[model samples]
Target chain A: MRLRLLCCGAALLLLAACSSTPDESLYSDGSGQLGGPPGPISPDGTIGSADLNGGQPAPGTQEDLELTVGDRVFFDYDSTVLSPVATETLDRQGAWLKQFGSIVITVEGHTDERGTREYNLALGDRRATAVKNYLVALNIAPERILTISYGEERPADPGNDETAWSNNRRAVTVVTTVN
Target chain B: MTLPRSPRARWLPALAWLAACLVLPRAAGAVVELDITEGVVEPVPIAITEFHGQTPAEQKFGRDLADVVTADLARSGLFRPLDRRAFIQSPAELIDLPRFADWRQINAEALVTGVITGGEGGTELAVEFRLWDVFAGNQMRGQRLSGTPDQWRRIAHKIADTIYARLTGEKGYFDSRIVYVAETGPTTDRVKRLAIMDQDGANHEFLTDGGDLVLTPRFHPDGNSLGFMVFRQPVPQVYKYDLLTGREARLGDFGGMTFAPRFSPDGRWLAMSQAENGNSDVYLLDLDSGRKRRLTDHPAIDTSAAFAPDGERLVFNSDRAGSPQLYTMRPDGGDVQRISFNGGNYGSPTWSPRGDLIAFTKITGGVFHIGVMKTDGSDERLLTESQLDEAPTFAPNGRVILFTRKDYRDNHIRLYTVDIAGGQVQELPTPLDASDPDWSPLRP
Candidate 1:
């Protein structure tokens, strides 16, 4: 009787796996490319979740480096210094960079479209400089880094609020690996 | 097909009178007039005869001066110069006789003929221009001017200005440039940089790379530098950039937000808004000393300040009265009085260059509009009503206001100009979307 129950449970599990959504059907090989059907569920049981916690992209997805507000550090109303949490994330990013070893990066700094042009240029300069400075401290060659600023011309989120503004204030680090 | 040639064309005075009478009547007009709100934008028919001078150098100066005038006017998307090959007479005789019949045959409605002579320090450039009712064969207006060779460019501008004023009844934009925040990329990650273009919207070049978010770029009184705000991580600081050298430095250390900056007409001081602890107020920074003096003490949002043309008074936007409205005060920050009361929240109040009016953005009934009023806040006229229209800057003559108009989708932005009389408004085309247009001071 116990063996019969086990066989029934296995059959139900196979049926559940076959009914997975398209997003759930995507899977990546260890080589970081699409390989096969996605596991019916993530190890954590979330079917359609971002793999940011694992420092990897979801299966079958291209690597997206576009910086959003959530990925960047926010400052107080008038500050530019990176916070502790920001530093921690940078550390993880630095480890990733060390592992890749052949990637060139450009860091862009930006602000909310609240200030004037000349001031924003200088402010953006400082923000990009801050990120570049941090990367260099992590033993990355300074020669491989390029910095630019868009002041407030670009926004990840266009809403006019603390939410949007926080997203707008960011320094993005984009990595390009030499093939 | 042969009309009798005027004696002026042949260097004979007698035949000129005969042709003038025969061809002149076409220039007369009945009392009826039509408003020219729109046209095909055909080039204005203009003829610049080679100017003569006493010496070869002076003569060369004369020709160069005419060429400059032709180039300036022709490039303005306005005037079309008649080919010199079609001229019936030499410049000297054309100035003396001005046979309207000869000009009319070639479709030349306006003519400029001049001569140059040696002056104390530079070649004396003298120019004479006539605005003609070509169809009527009558001269509308004529004037002669003399200045140094170095002033040849100015003389050309003056002529263009006069001709434009006479033909269109509107001031010319030939002597101006536009400073705008140039935008690129997707809606989510837009890259904005400071850029300047000729007043007609040509010669666009980025002053700063797209790395930071800059806003409210205003040309200094001299048109050589710009003052704007920069957000460095946590602080929005004010700074000025010398367009010629690309040298930029901090304008002031407001500790909080320093924005809405404008340079006094003399370029000696800057007026802007400073927000500390969430309360924005107006302040002025002395360009030389970098010393900031508070202009307003209210706790409400006091921003978008501008100096009157005379540099003795200022106009600014303030919500101190419960909603945004325009206010004026003496340069010393005294005698503050309300200047706008028609309705809707008003901000970005820029004083007219002529010192007679102020242009501002008004938000009322869920629409954004560009409006103008006298310095005393009277005779208000809304120039444009749009989904989003703000940042109005005046042309040097105070005849037009150039501002940004955002489309209904909030995705596209275009530059537009409106006549101060509220009669004509036109959109300026650009390869890419543009915003935050700041008009340069009249070319010196």
Candidate 2:
């Protein structure tokens, strides 16, 4: 018991230290024109938030795709139907994949903590399939894409509130090919 | 008769019962019918005396046996084991003659007395106990179990099971084992390994090394094997674990993500869910023929299949009707009937070994609950409410349920067992975090 408490304390310290650093999901548009993730509220309106990231992410990289065209689409609770915004994100993703034709991708489906493991696994699979189908309709080769469901296992946001859950219920397009 | 000679044998005493000298004078009205529906059951006050012994080691074993047996019966929630500090009649005095007056004076309705005799060190230990109904002034049960001293705890469980059976008229679940996924690390990158322990949370051993993530372990009816899911390179697949050999092999080539594996009650078939192209369906793998048959072809999640004790019907979880709910079908997947109709989403349905109840996880109002209902879907009773409680497995006797609870307090997932009536919940101990519990049948 003492050891477990000590480990928990150590983990808390690690979490405290890690939270200060920006995670990969903190996307910043190179021009900083968009108000979505990391920007639009520059303190003096002189420096674009992209300056915080030093420079634009390299083209054809995961960061580049995440910044240039979005790499994730969110889902509603217990749903696989793609919202219009999700489709817009997938369409951009499809065009990016066409640009980088040789790069293979894996679509990872995820869910919130509200469901059981087995059912959420299936639900996440369906969500991934939904994104994959949308991209396939745009003529992306099915052979270049793989889908895996993480269920609620890997949450993008660890918080349990509705806002956290909305972010967690998502399909993430990951660059699986070696550069 | 030859006894199983392996020192690691799980139940030498249970086997010893085959040749045990039995004497149970079941007096009229002695069997107490447990009011399982009540939230607070008036526990039967029972006094247990340390077994009498001649040698110093024997005396210690006697004391340890009493402690173990008392714990087992007390955890059942049907008996209130009297504090040993309050016993007026000493161990020697009780063994000489259990004075019913002394027992009744302490408000004890039942008295248990025993004596231990054994060889030294590596030999056998023979223990015997008698249950006396202090109210009726008659003996309720008497039995003897002999085993190696290493098997002392098993012997104690056997004695407790026998006493519980005599008093409650239902089979006892004490002398059983549980296989579950022992968990560690953060929820984002959890490490889960297959683990086993006594039902009372002793003698814990991890079967797998945690290199692969394991989930939902279900023991075969023979208690020698388990079927569970493992996440390997390509996808998650159902795998069978041989308890005796510590060997594991994939159950089938489902060609997709397969999980939620459960052994049919008869151990001849393994049912699991296989998802292909986002459509998850239930399939049965015949153990004898090495063939797989699809039970449900719906484009919804249909999984968590468990067979009734008689092996005629299977109760499973499904979302084909839009939301997750409990459903029952024949073993051949015909006669599908929807069983859960409440507003909440229900999943992880497991049929009781007694063929009377189906236990499941109900998600209502954002809180997960473990609940039970009759096989016909009536008389639903929720047993627990927590931030996250899923995948309930009934005890061997079907009187108790074991499930996993994600403790928001500690950010830990642990195993817990509650009575079917929803009282006396216990956090079963493990060396590490745990989840996805599966109780094994009584050792043969």
Local distance difference test scores for all models: 0.67, 0.82
Best by DockQ: 2
B1-444: candidate 2 lDDT, tens digit per residue: 333323235434333553236575467865334554456778888898899888998899999999999999999888999998988988877665577888888999888898899836857888879888887777878888887787788889989988888777788888889999898877778788989988998888889998988888889998888888888878788899887667899887767898888888778899888888888888899988889988987878888888889989999888888899999999788999999987799988999999999999999989999999999899899999999999899999998999999877767888898988777679998899988899989764
Per-residue lDDT of model 1, residues B91-141, tens digit only: 667646677788778877666666565643553455555555655656665
> How well does chain A score by TM in each candidate?
0.62, 0.71
Query: lDDT tens digits, residues A1-179, model 1?
Result: 99877755654564464445433112211111222343233465443323222223332121322211112444443346787756755665565566656667666677764443323443555577677788789998877666666655566677755666676677777664453
True contacts kept of 1: 0.21
Model 1 stretches astray by more than 4 angstroms = A1-179, B1-97, B104-109, B113-158, B165-173
Candidate 1: lDDT of B274?
70
Q: TM-score, chain B only, every model?
A: 0.73, 0.94
Question: Candidate 2: deviation at residue B312, Å?
Answer: 1.2
User: How would you encode candidate 2's per-residue C-alpha lDDT over A59-131 as one tens digit per residue?
Assistant: 6888777766877888888999988777877878888999999988989999998888888888888899888
